[model samples]
Target: MKRMVSASAAAVSMLLAGTTHAAVVPDYQLNSSWYSNAQNAISARSTSLSADSKAKNIIVFVGDGMGISTQTAARILQGQSQANNQGGEENYLSFEHFPHSGLAKTYNTNQQTPDSAGTMTAMMSGAKTKAGVIGVSDNVNRGDCDVSSERLVSALELAASQHKATGIISTARITHATPAATYAHVSERNWEASVPEECVGKVSDIAYQLIHQAADIDVIMGGGRRNFLPEEVTDPEGSTGRRSDGNNLIEDWQNFHRTGQYVWDSEGFNAIDTSSTSKVLGLFNSSHMEYEADRDDADEPSLSAMTEKAIDILLNDTHQQQQQGFFLMVESGRIDHAHHGGNAARALQDTIEYSNAVQAAIDKLDAAGELDDTLIIVTADHSHVFTMAGYPKRGNPILGLVVGVGSEQPSLAGDNKPYTTLGYANGPGAAASFDAGVRTDLSALDTKQLDFQQQALIPSGSETHAGEDVAVFARGPQAYLIQGAIEQNVIFHAINQAADLGGNAYVAEE
Candidate 1:
């Protein structure tokens, strides 16, 4: 009898412990006062509101290659430079205004200088992998059938499983690397145009899977219409020089269209009825949409305009009460393109446009009283090699040569010293020649020199990406999780923890 009683007591204790663990809430605490206030606001709401508010909506804004220096350069070019004598500082971008901010280290397992495919795969799936790998683990050999269940699930996929609406907006082709990381899986990132033969009958192409498999992605904007259309029907210029499946995908989409609405240009996009629509497909260019600076009024919709339209249509679902919300991913993808091409003017313009989109989202959410309940995260996937130096007069134009150092300085004697405005650490276009005619003044030169001089090395004229930590800014609940330096994949865990979402889908168990 004594032995039986002891066994019963042990069982009872185990039951009690299990019950207690089940009742415990996940850890979603904030480390900063600002985030604490936001958390208080979230908890104080009525039970019904709070219940629906458990991350009902998530909006992630990715500045493709716009790192800290990119933001500073954009601000300077926009006349909001910190050097300006204006008394009041320039207003923060919508994302910048977020109360919590953190930094993320971007590097792939295989490469120091990472590509968008690997970085975004980590961002979307929470798993770190090699440079060219996407949607799957680097541990899995490229074409091996015996790949591990180590596959990571995207936040969008998780939200879809919970009956939430999901949307992907970008300035690049819908099938581009960053956006594709959210839905498609493959060993290679360039597989956008190539659909596996096995996937043909079993699963649609990645593009089709994104539109069909999940919760009928409500809003699909940006370019890559050619990928959807068959070769015969494709516009000459729209063919991305890549072919897939030998079938026009655009026709397939149209045939599969149920309540879907399609818009090819800005005019058609503007004509859509956001209040009554549930599904929208707007592909403005045959490839990626034109850059914001180069896009004609008739051809493409502005990033801000597209963002507003997406929000309007997403909110149309009767299911999204103040408590139940949606999930949106907006990408300012062209900044990376501009940097790759080494066009400073074009890159800065796109950055400004991206900032405008952030402001637009803030205005819409604030007006609807949803800002406090919503968590806004803004960050870049990686850093670029761009740098600014060259001290000119107090009011000198940022584009001009540096005033106080280098052989280009006017005040410096022959072969003495001068200065330049721009610099790069590893760029092919660093300054190597000491041209006397391009000299400037060098009176107040700083002791430390710039990262690189103009026309110094390879002369390719384009800056490259650096292996450095990039900044992450946040506002709303759990903003404090973004403090100090952290690995890039930590972002996924921080966001999941703050939203009270469970599971370590990406991390390996010790």
Candidate 2:
């Protein structure tokens, strides 16, 4: 969605006159970590709590379900894949060298182990909400229809309100919880295309909200084209639309922006010249995009390509309009899906690609000499239950069997069975017969295969999220605020302070 050229006068009014409405987030939530940690971040840097905003642009990279263990394993995989044949432990992901890093407590207001909707809401809106909701306060119940009063403004909304360019990129459905949190305020995350009959007109679906409410967004690229098209229509990929309301939100998106371009494949994506394109909507798949290892480059653009193009388009907007810099959120969304399937190979591969996307942004900004003026934050919304266990050699293949140092043979447990270095606490990969006290033998199985499910301790239909702290790394203006252990919601405050969005930075009383 893009702000209309005809509304330029109103846009300027809103930017100079302040927001037309106040965010409905509770005062208690606002005064919580969002205020304290922001003050603490400035204090730690020996700067004024209400210091002048420094960052002209902000880019947030989210590696969905990329935990500490996943990061370590992926680092090794990336290093070992290099031509130098070096030991993998010494290598670091691109964002690891970001200068400032911290741990975030990833818990929802209702659940100990968080869901993406809540975690992303906390990061984008500066408030921790209930697990299944997006861009709303904790007061609303899951699936509730009466949520207009519970709306919480996100960092993207703040940037849009200030007449700044904004964009969202995800490997998952654009309507998925994490990306949806940037703009949609739904009481239930499942309301992607149409809500239940009772909530039909009262609550607009997430895709509809993206087209109507958050229409000011400058860039939108991801899967879930089915959610936007009429059920009678079939996409170029031969997938039928899923919307039951007969409303084609994709058409509405194009109609909303005079210069908007909607693309469905790599050809159309590559054809766009960012210098002249004011807005773009790219939906490459009907559902979630393919994992990096399984993706066809001709059908879908790589995450790094999307990142580069998004930066270029947003950068062009700022220069063309003489507006403040842009705000972009990019997510490697399929990392979580691969982990859920108990496929560590695809998970680690997606994580590596996520790192490449981060590097792409760094390189793009560095080339344009805007790296220092941009605030880049790379973090995960929450972690998976994935784990890396056993004592393996430094040069061991991260996806191979666990072989002890100086031992070529795989390590065997008391039951005399071999296991891989990577596994899950619970998933489809559980031992063949746990009740019979039998563990599957991995001696003949190739654990490095993309379809190979790692051995798990408990049998579960799907892996669950873990209730542990996730890491946050940052660089450039106000990056110092990311240090130390802080509540997850503090992320929004740091961004707000960096860009002075909403003009709501807390000022210490002298």
Scored by TM-score, the top model is 2
TM-score of each predicted structure versus truth: 0.77, 0.92
Across 1-510, the per-residue lDDT of candidate 1 in tens digits comes to 111101133432432232211111111212222223323333333222323234546788888998787787676655544454442124355567677787887988788878887888777665677786666666655543322233444566555545567688999988887887776655665556655665444334556545444335668888877766655564634455345556655555566776678888888898998877777888778888888878887778988898888888877743364224677889989888777655555677798899889889888887777777667788888878777764454434444455653334343335566544544554444333324445333445432222223433234556677778788887766666666676676666555545654332222234
User: Evaluated with lDDT, which candidate comes out highest?
Assistant: 2
For each candidate, the alpha-carbon lDDT, in order, equals: 0.63, 0.84
Clashing pairs in 2: none
Q: What TM-score would candidate 2 get against the native?
A: 0.92
Which residue segments of model 1 deviate by more than 4 Å?
1-53, 80-91, 142-150, 195-205, 212-215, 236-241, 318-323, 393-395, 404-420, 426-456, 459-463, 501-510
Clashes of each: 31, 0
lDDT of 2 by residue, 225-292 (tens): 99999899998889999998899888888788777889999999999999989789999999999899
C-alpha-based local distance difference test score of model 1: 0.63
Q: Report residue 401 deviation for candidate 2 (angstroms).
A: 0.6
Candidate 1 — worst ten consecutive residues by lDDT sum? Answer: 20-29
Clashes of 1: 31
